[model samples]
Target: MSEPLLSIHDFSVTYDVDPPVHAVKGVTLELARGEILGLAGESGCGKTTLAYGVQRLLKAPAVITNGSVMFHDASGEDVDINALGAEEMRRFRWDKISMVFQGAMNSLNPVAQIGSQLEDVFEVHRPEMTPRQRRSEVADLLELVRVGAQRARSFPHELSGGMRQRVMIAMALALRPQLMVMDEPTTALDVLVQREIIRQISQLRHEFGFSVIFITHDLPLLLEITDRIAIMREGEIVEVGRAEQIWTDPQDAYTRTLLSSFPRLTGERGVVVR
Candidate 1:
């Protein structure tokens, strides 16, 4: 197997409150380079919290009390991301790793043109690029997500839900980060739109060779796209296995229950395990 591109060793998180709420337990996981790993769990299961912790996006009242996040970059240098300083982390965020926030379609600025929003990423990360270069880059990015260049002049409110989500994805990929952390990237879209966005992500992954840590509660979608699945519950990962093994022979009762919660498209309920 290839060396782990990202490693979590006994990581834990807590929210400050009366007696404190443990949002994540000691969870050790690994992601190989260019692999799509799914984090499956219901809401409040610490899936997002874990992703936030890895990216050092946790704000006040939430603390990482234990463990470390080791990120091995393409240059073969490994660094404990949790230990980086503010300046170092600023450089690390988009250049080496980028995150697509939950409900990201709604995260775009309604007042700004889509092309301007896309250009902002380059402005902040690649300031050396001239104005003409940034505009050209923005056009290329729009084409990459299959959003035609004509829509670049349109505002966020002018695009459909899936197109907006694609714009968000284009911005995240602008820096060409080694790892992309997608937190419920397909949420709120209709079934068909969700499928299209998922398909686009898979194709982009194949073409770009970037790894993804895809977080979502949708088990069926994860099984369809991810190479491996990690089942999380109550802030803990209960089972981790390959997609086929997880679907056919879940090792945990919770995993089985999760699989049973989703109705299959062929009018079969138990076929995932068959």
Candidate 2:
């Protein structure tokens, strides 16, 4: 197999506080080119924290105790991302790697139009593009994410939650990043809308050709989309394997129990009733 595009080795993060919360504990994972790896876990289990750790985007009081996140660039440079300076990281954030935050519907500016918000991504990362080029790029991005170009003129509040999420995906794709991190990309929406967004995300990945780290707590949904799944608990990974394999034969007790909790309709072993 080709070398993974991103590798997190022995990564751990601890927050500096009175009790010193340990968010992630020695977690290691990899994402190869065009691969989709889902990080599934309950809240407080460190999935989001680990995403922040990989990009070195953790805020103050969050300390990386040990280990490193290495990004293997297309040019064959293995960049130790943990050591990247803020300026380099700023450059890397969009062009090299992009992240789609949970509740990205709320992330868009209330005052700004969707086109302007998408333009902001292009502005920050591709500042040299002419105004015409920027508009073309923004329009194209909106189309790519399955949002009508007309919606670009609308505000985030004017659109539905799913549309806003698609806009976020469009913004994340503006740079054609090699890796995209999605944390709970489809939470809080009704079932139909969530399914629509997830389907769109999968289709867009096929169209754009980028690796994705899709994080969510929903096991049934994650199983449908991701190639591989990493099951986490208590700040550590309990299992990591292909979706079908884990669904059929989870070796870890915790993983099996979690599977039991999410019984799929077109079911197999994991979804089997007691």
Best by TM-score: 1
Local error of candidate 1 at residue 242 (angstroms): 0.5
Clashing pairs in 1: none
TM-score of 1: 0.96
lDDT of 2 by residue, 31-109 (tens): 8888999999999999999998898889889999988899999898999998889899989987889999988888899
Whole-model lDDT, candidate 1? Answer: 0.92
- lDDT of model 2 at residue 261? 86
List the RMSD of every prediction in angstroms.
2.5, 2.4
Tens-digit lDDT track for model 1 on 161-203?
9999999999999999989999999978999999988899889
lDDT against the true structure, per candidate, is 0.92, 0.88
Q: State the TM-score for model 2.
A: 0.94
Looking at candidate 2, the ten consecutive residues that score lowest on lDDT are: 264-273
Candidate 1: misplaced stretches above 4 Å?
267-274
Model 2 per-residue lDDT at 118: 85
